[model samples]
Target: MADDPFQSRFAADASLLPHMADLANDRVLVALLAEADYRAASFLDQRLLTDRVGREWMAWDALPDLGAAAAGPHFIFHIGHVGSTLVSRLLAEVGDVLPLREPMLLRTLAQVAERIERPESVWSPELYRTRLAQTLGWLGRGFAPGQRAMVKASSVITAVADDLTGSDGRALFLHVPLPRYLETILAGEASMAETLAQAPARMARLAALLPDFPHALWQLPPVTRVAMSWLCEMATAQRRLPPDDPRRLWVDFEAMLADPAAALMAQATHFGLPIDPARIEAALAGPIMRQYSKAPEHGYTPDLRRELQAQAAADHAPAIAEAIAWVEALAARYTNLADLPILGDQSVIQEVRCSS
Candidate 1:
């Protein structure tokens, strides 16, 4: 490495992780991150980039390209509040995995991807593709030779899942049934506020997919607004990683909670990671399971989550029923949404007791 902090050791070292891609400014913010730093931080966004972390911004073109030879940089794409962080934590604990949770750079790229074809787009198609490859190469670097870099993307990043993942790239699409998803989001004031705030953008994305998407964001109540969020994300996943795709694995978060060790083992195999049953067992029994994944100091467990969901469901039963009916109506009208494995499987929904 050179004396210059931003001297472009992106290809050679995993420490210089690209923290943010400022497309408007044509620069990338790179941060020096160690194994401990990656493990300690919940998200690799501006929140985690404290004054203590060494960082600098470099022009986009100045970044060295590692080309198409970068190693495994698989992904975990999930609907929000579905234990995606927990999955990332468990994988990180099992070894041979370099976990990068919600890196803001990817979010920037996803936003750029949404407008790449538009007349007013900042990046031309060629530059966007090149930068996407370069960013992935930078993210693919690992502390050890065989350690695979696994990114658990922010929920909305699913909008560009197809663009981010190559044909050979493997991804786990984590989600829960619609009713459970509503319960989880509606249970928290912050989560509900986020859902409402993001509803318009999500509705726009959903309209792009389903040309006849009928309801406006203003037309829907709070509960259905949350349902629309699920539909938009889950539909994006369905379109991007179809069931026939060999590189994609679909994992239900509820099923994972039921049998975590087995779920972890299966997920490891899906990503071609080396399996250590002992390590998986240790992770399940470890502190990560007991602590809130996004904030380790806060204690949160599956039992607590269930209690919250139950209370939310009971308190808002009428609104929830209306939201479910709204989704069911859409599913019936749209062939693409009709056969969604989560929506179609009554046994799965019934097992969760989402319908009483």
Candidate 2:
């Protein structure tokens, strides 16, 4: 290991992960990680930074330019609570993809990108662009020569989806129907808390798109706030990952649940990974599907999720209906949201139910 405090060893060794960026200080926090560490982590954020992991801070300028050899560090952008972590875990089981889930640095970059042009912005336009490029390059490195990096970004990171993935980049935009999204969020105390915590940021993003955005965060009920979170994320996805883009794939989480093998194959093909039916089947049948992905020790299954959603639907029927109506009203008002693909797609929902 090198003794220099300011030099980044990430280029020479992929184990040194760039955990987070300090934009104001012009340095990045790097953590030493191994293949097993990446596999074991549910998130690449502070939770994964334990006392056992070696850490250092490197000047941004000292970070090496490894862009030439970088391949896709592709993306999995989604609306929160939509089983993205599960998808990332299954993909990791497939053997050729390295999954980086919800890296804190991406969230930091997203925050900065939101105000890059404002007076309070921390980085100049030139520096921001340079750092963004460097970050992407750093993320693209994998342990093996042929393995590809797949980033599962946090939900809010979708606000910068366009920046993270340019014209030629590949990604999977995952989401669920409004009614179901509300049910899932409302069913859990922690989920509702997260929804409320993120409401202010979601509101600001929504306001940017819909200037006449009605209702302050406090004015709306909890269900309505959840709906606003969905709109902010889904609208950003629709704008950044257009329907016509060949490189981007739009997948409904319900549709994925309907046929795990098919969905996994489609995603694998999209990312140019080798597809083996046997391996896909094994991954599906393995413990990943049965256990709650974010916390593997807690047992959770598709059936359990359906039961929870059913209870939530029965318990919060009125609020769920109101939330759906609210979203429909916005769709009617905004031309951009009028044709949002999965809003009322009965066929997809029916397929999931039928398969189940």
Give per-residue CA lDDT, model 1, range 67-174, as digits (tens).
788764889999899999999999988868889999999988888898899998999999889988888888888988788889999999988888788878999999
- Report how far off residue 239 is in candidate 2 (Å): 1.1
Clash number for model 1? Answer: 0
Q: What are the per-model C-alpha RMSD values against the true structure? A: 2.5, 2.2
Per-prediction TM-score, please? 0.95, 0.95
Clash pairs, model 2 backbone: none
- Local error of candidate 1 at 349, Å? 5.8
Model 1 ranges with Cα > 4 A deviation:
1-8, 342-356
Q: On residues 88-164, what C-alpha lDDT tens digit does candidate 2 reach at each position? A: 99888875988899989998898888889999998888877877887888888888888888999999898888889
Candidate 2 Cα outliers beyond 4 Å, as residue runs: 1-9, 354-356
